[model samples]
Target chain A: MSTPVTSNPAQEESTVDHSKIKVSPEEMEAYDQSGRKPVLLGFFIAVVWLLIGTVLGDLSSFKFDRPDLLTEQAYLTFGRIRPAHLNVMVYGWASTAMFSVSLWLMPRLCRTPLRWGNLAVIGILVWTVGLGVGIALLLAGHGDGLEWLELDRQWADPLLVIGAAMVGASVWKTLAARNVHHLYVSIWYVAASYPWFLIIFLAGNMPFYKGVESAAVNWFYAHNALGLWLTTINLGLIYYLLPKIIGRPIYSYWLSLVGFWGLALFYALNGMHHLIGGPLPSWMIATSITASIMMIVPVVAVGINQHMTVVGRFGAMRYSPALTLAVIAAMSYTAVSLQGILTALVSVNRITHFTHWTIAHSHLGLYMFVTLSLFGGMYYILPRVLKKEWPSRRLVRAHILLVGGGMVLYIVALGIGGVLQGLSLLAPGEGFEASVSSAKPWLLLRSVSAVIISAGHLVFAYHAYLLAFTSRNSLTRHPPFYELKPVLVKKRVP
Target chain B: MTRILVLIMGAMATVIFALVILVILPNSMLSDLKAPPQLKQPGQQELLGRQLYISNGCIYCHTQQVRDPVFTTDIHKGLGNRPSVPADYVYDAPHLLGTMRTGPDLFNVGTRLPDRNWHLLHLYQPRALVPWSIMPGFPFLFEHKPTAEAGDKVLDIPKPYAPSEGVVIISKEAEALVAYLISLQHNYPAPDSDALEEVQP
Candidate 1:
């Protein structure tokens, strides 16, 4: 007979009787695993980045609330840290964690050991330093003053090329040794995103597109880097996890193929919508709008396929964290995407353009949808990759409740704030300052939302900390799977 | 199992989307927007100047629309317009719905910088032009190839070119962007007589 091993280290260490425990050979072998330590260490680093991203976000939000709050400091001003918050969230937190996960998971998925462990380490170091140096350049007032590509031109080129090299090499080796016939959807997305971003990046920021083309090129890069680079990777996670969690085949493999091509073709041309009224040519704007509108095809197709796969899965939403997160992400696809289409239209854009409404829309897409999906994917993947269960259910619940509640408050408040501000500005005879004053209350509400969100993220980092450091032998053993009759989900209609 | 919850959400989205496009947009666009009246095009010289303004990336820093009433308080700041109208942009091939205002919106640039020579001097050195202007000067826009052992100076605006004198003319691309800028006007209502005929016609 064997003693039950505890995966929760905190629980094991706190117990009074160490002599009472007997560890099985399987538990001993899992205990001997060295890969778990680095994964935990990587998580701690990710936590620190999360704190920095949140603080920067909160600090920048304060500038909107109090325009002259610490206005004397040049580096601490709104403009500098605004890009800093974005980069830290985009590059530091999301990119770094995704890199860490891919490096760890790809080898396991391919059933081969990582060839050059040093390359992964080098990649993390280079990627981190690039984010720091680029942000330092931005705060020092050397930024190119373009959104997303706001890093100084001097640092931007090398940073782009070097960072791409690191991620590319690691991903290449992992894919080279494949154990399975089918390359998972996540692999397809993660693989394509690296080269795609690398090409689009060099084209936009090589200091070649100087005059009239620079503005056009900058918008193009800003939209795609987020869309094709980040969003596609997150979507890959949903395709895999949503099916896996429910223990079902995907609703339609053919729909998956259609969604893939539809996204690739439509997303690249969609950037021009951001330049709606900008002096870019009508043909360009019309093409972008058509592309933006055409995006509905992929969104609806993917949405229905995903939905049909999960039909009658409402009970799982109560039990499975991954399913809940993935489902919300799927829902956000429709909301933010439709918002993107409407905003791209010129007449509707007349009010929404240049307003905080765009920022709200951005959050719904980037934070609520994309990042949340990644976080959800992490909940499932991190356990298997590290070969350890979570230390506590309570911390996980705290993370879910806080972040979920916090974002809804944030997204809703900003939308209202933007709409009110937009209406007052459009009001006849109203002066600019007066319209601004009317929107101040909403801006104040937004600041409060930022505070709540930062708190939620802090709680999330804590939960992630517990998950990483805990040993598998310390977890109260769970049944690998409970036998159940599979419920039939509906097939999608043409 | 299926997403019974999200199906309701899916149904809700279709309805909300229908309401927004069909009901919201048409009512707003069809209403009396009371924007400033349409202005005539720049004289060919100014049209040349406006094209010069655009080619140089001036619009990156400057916006043409005061903010929408629903968006900001800037509606009346560029006074004589309520919210800008679709008719105002009828001639604009590439609509310039500029997002930022790093510099002032030039919706009424004609009124703001009416002096012809001022526009020329400003293009040469914007800091000298506005005193408070943060904009960089377009020294390259002016023709200034150096002579042997002599300091560089602008090749004068144009020379009555002959065997006697040497200077290159400014390119038409530069002139076009600037003419577009010089053409911006916030105060030009159609005549009462012209309005009635056009409305009827």
Candidate 2:
């Protein structure tokens, strides 16, 4: 072990002895080896989906401005392509990426070699095939038609369930054999998400419910998929990555406790807020609205915890690319959650429910918060797993700036435009065309932002390919688990 | 050991709690709802049209629900006769209560614009009727014919939208989709239990 070199008293005060947290190289190697094939396979497939999803997203956004561009083919039509973009991003890119991250995170947190790693590999393969077939069926005009549940229920959804079960089994087995007696907060989140997702997925695809009841179940499943599945897992990643990068423990364990239970309790009820003033019982909508507001408890708890953890270490973000993206994503979690609460209020939902503002809000939550978290996890995980430095630091910087900047522009432009469009619709004297006109210029801006974001995705994808395939084993020694260390600023003797 | 059990069980209990409250309860509560006397189950053609609408992903752009007039201008804006109630949609399977209104609400569209020909032209080329509209034309849903056949419904597309050599004829899919759109009339009186009291402006 290396000696602790302390050059400044101030720095010494803040820096903990990381030696206590460091694992034996052999143990880490065992963990990494167990996860290697599954993680890489999952990541490679995820990148392909990311690129495909980006192209589809760009086409869909462009269609909003110029709907005539791809009218020659039925498959390329805006309606089909729009859902294709959504599914590919949510299930294809985000889901695969999250699964890969979990494969790595679970082993590390459990202090055990991953059990049944082959199951995960098979799971990923099955998932990829299912998603591909599902997207094809959608384009071929055979969708189930529920938003966020458009995949063919009979053929496609069954495969996804089977694939997910295999993956979940592997993770669960690893957790069961964990060396540690106590489970971490991250494990709790990851463990919970599996069952939560299974319940919702099955419920969403069930064929029995008809009419408004189906709509009720649809939103119920859709919102929980976000809250329980995506949000839950990504929040777990944030909890693990934020402190690990900063070389600090989380600011408050109790806050994590509050955040977790608060989310599980509140988020499930928040779905019906989407149908406010629609064809549901007013009491149900009111319950959702109340639950939506109650979400502030979790959001604030998480926000404060993450903020306080990184309070003095803001300078660390300059050196670690992962830190920068993860911190931004952490902040976005708070921003998007707060915005969601406000949007759920009757006064705001009245205007925003059916407009482009809701689109902007979804993007904020999905792209800015969840997708960025996955990217940050990838940046940290790939180097350790592949045992090499990133091929090009410049490419990573380019991706961060392009995607981050584009998201800001996207949310602002579409958010304002959606408000204007909603107001126009509400005005008694204004024609329906006025709402379309009001949204036109902003839709054009959204296309521009999509182009920027797509360029970023391409840069990251190429970098990932180079890292996985072409990069030399330049890292002779194992890279440090955490990238950031306290910089001891020495006092100059007068 | 107990802690792990608590964590897993606690997590699961929350979801079950939500499912019971949000899904199962509402489902049972609304299960007994009967379609109003004025509401009719769509005919076979209209059902086929509904399938086409679903397959084509029309619900992504157009909504079928009309919000309460107190909260929205849905009624004043001529989207529906009354706010949509659970009874208004008893026959719909895989309901089309879409989230976005990129296009106008279609719940009462059959009542709003009853012309079959107009819907056909709009589906073939939306911009033909509404020039500034961003809706995609389902040209693939139509067939180009050198000459019209007997009993064929040929689309009279405007000058800019029309092909120079052939006339546009509606396919079974497009016709069904139009039938579905025309069958979306839910102007029936709301059930007393679900009706909102009129508020003085």
Candidate 3:
């Protein structure tokens, strides 16, 4: 042991093959070639979806600001379009774009190329057709009136099945063509998410759950989609991208695996927490609450892992749009999930459930964590996918500032409004009318934030059009002003 | 070695845990969960109106579950209950708790707006009704095909897609929505004494 002997049992000296460690020129070319196009296409589509979704959202918000904006037109009513806006963002904008990025990222993380590129284009088309029909049906007042499940059953069921079929083929192909062995944590998360959705979504949306039982299932599906599919996949991507870009091993891979299991075990059941103290069974509601509170384990572990990995190396925030949005999303996830656990308490649920307070809680997850994370993912992805940097960094800077400020203002305003509404109605001798009045101001502020978000979306649309429509060389010549400072990754351990 | 049992148990716990979600599928309505409300009487029109509310998706926005005296959250915005009773909906086909207040909870609206004319105007054009309402105008409910402008028709109206124009100043659907709204109250057993009337701060 005293001698540095290679064969000593006590001294477990490790030998690493430098040849395997370094990527050969051929390998580097393969990686760059594989990573570039998909990410560019994914980000561009994401920006377009964001543009349209944000416009619809602003229109709906405008109804609250001046409820007479589109009174004559039935389709544009807040009642009709609120669900439309949500679906557009959920499916058309965020999820689709996320899929594009994930397609590229998943393959890269697994050390493989995308399996069938042509099929992906087919999947996008099929899913788009489904969404277009679904949106038109909703606007036509043929909607089933189920939140998130509003798509008429005729359109919804087939759409989900087809969407799954395309994706199933795509994911399987990617997994089989792997060039590396120890599959990364991001791949694990993304892999677990898809089939889980197929099972849960099919079962939950099954027609056997009719009437109020179906309502319960609707809430269950609505929430689980976010938990199991959207949130999980986004977090998985971040886990891969953050460390790889920063050139650091994740702070603790063990913690990440634990977080995965904890989340998978807890999140699906937490759906019933929304129906606490309602008509649902004591056990059903109680289990939801328990599962929800137990969620702190995953929350803490993942939070610490993501945060610690980025802590010292966060100066990458200046140059990388993905890192900046990703860090914010990480922080928001911790905050939102912590808030989720806190709100699940029965005493708190008494004040929060059935009020705008619940709305406020949900937005923390949707807008802050899911939306921002996906946005960050897009910002990182589109450049590589489109084969050109963004045409204007000013637009990007303006976008971040506008959207971040808008979200904060929007969330805070709605939160304060929701709490007041809950407390006021709960207060002894208070009238329900008073609760309605209290929320009005917050809705008004949210409308303002919606305008801010709209401006940001417009800037984004212009950027996306440049990528999607314009030539790559033209964009390169007109790169955003912020790029001029030559924002490169900041390495600290000199 | 014993700790290993706990480890296997721990990993196995998640699989067993999911079985709980399987049993929760068939759930009870809000009316089933609570005691019957203390209301004394409901008018004939209000009863018929509630049936219309369900078939038309009015219940999608109007939850009927009134908060206890300790809380009146719905009362502030223009809704409330007089302590809901199972009996109030004893004649109901589907008990509407009036969840989803995208418009507003309508439990207490009846007592305040006893006038039938106002509700008619509001339902025809919700802006003509409540200009600031985000509620979609139910132009489809009013009769465009066979226009009637005289009186309420009590029919076994089967087709939900077809609009029913009553032979009166208002449509039967509009009347039904109003009748349902008027049924909403904060005092189920209308307080004989003014002092007993619940007041919000």
* CA-lDDT, candidates in order: 0.60, 0.86, 0.64
DockQ of each: 0.04, 0.59, 0.12
lDDT, candidate 3, A398-472, per-residue tens: 878787888888888888887886776566576545666777888898888889878877876776676667785
**Which ten contiguous residues of candidate 1 chain A have the minimum total lDDT?**
A479-488
Q: How many clashes in each candidate?
A: 57, 1, 43
Q: What range of 10 consecutive residues in model 2 chain A has the weakest lDDT sum? A: A485-494
The residue ranges of model 2 lying beyond 4 angstroms of the native Cα positions read: A1-21, A473-494, B193-201
- Name model 1 segments beyond 4 Å from true: A1-44, A108-111, A114-117, A470-473, A478-494, B1-201
RMSD of 3: 8.3
Best by TM-score: 2
Residue-by-residue lDDT tens digits, candidate 2, A1-494: 32223344443222232223467777777798789999999988989999999999999999888888889789999889999999999999999998898899999887789988999999989988888889999999888889999999987999999888888888888998886655677898887888789889998899999988899899999999899999988998988888888888778767878899999999998999889898887888888999999999999999998999889987777666778778989999999999999999989988888899999999999999999999998988898898887766668778888999899999999999999998988888999899999999999999899999998999999888878887564553433323433222233222
Which CAPRI level is candidate 1?
incorrect
- Across residues B47-152, which tens digit of lDDT does each residue of candidate 3 receive? 6666455434565456655443333333344444444433343333334543455455565667768887677656555555453465555554454535443464
lDDT of 1 at A79: 54
lDDT of 1 at A202: 63
Candidate achieving higher lDDT, 1 or 2:
2
So what's the TM-score on candidate 2?
0.94
State how far residue B137 of model 1 sits from its true place (Å): 26
> How would you encode candidate 1's per-residue C-alpha lDDT over A272-339 as one tens digit per residue?
67756543334555767998899988888788888887888655655556677888888888788888
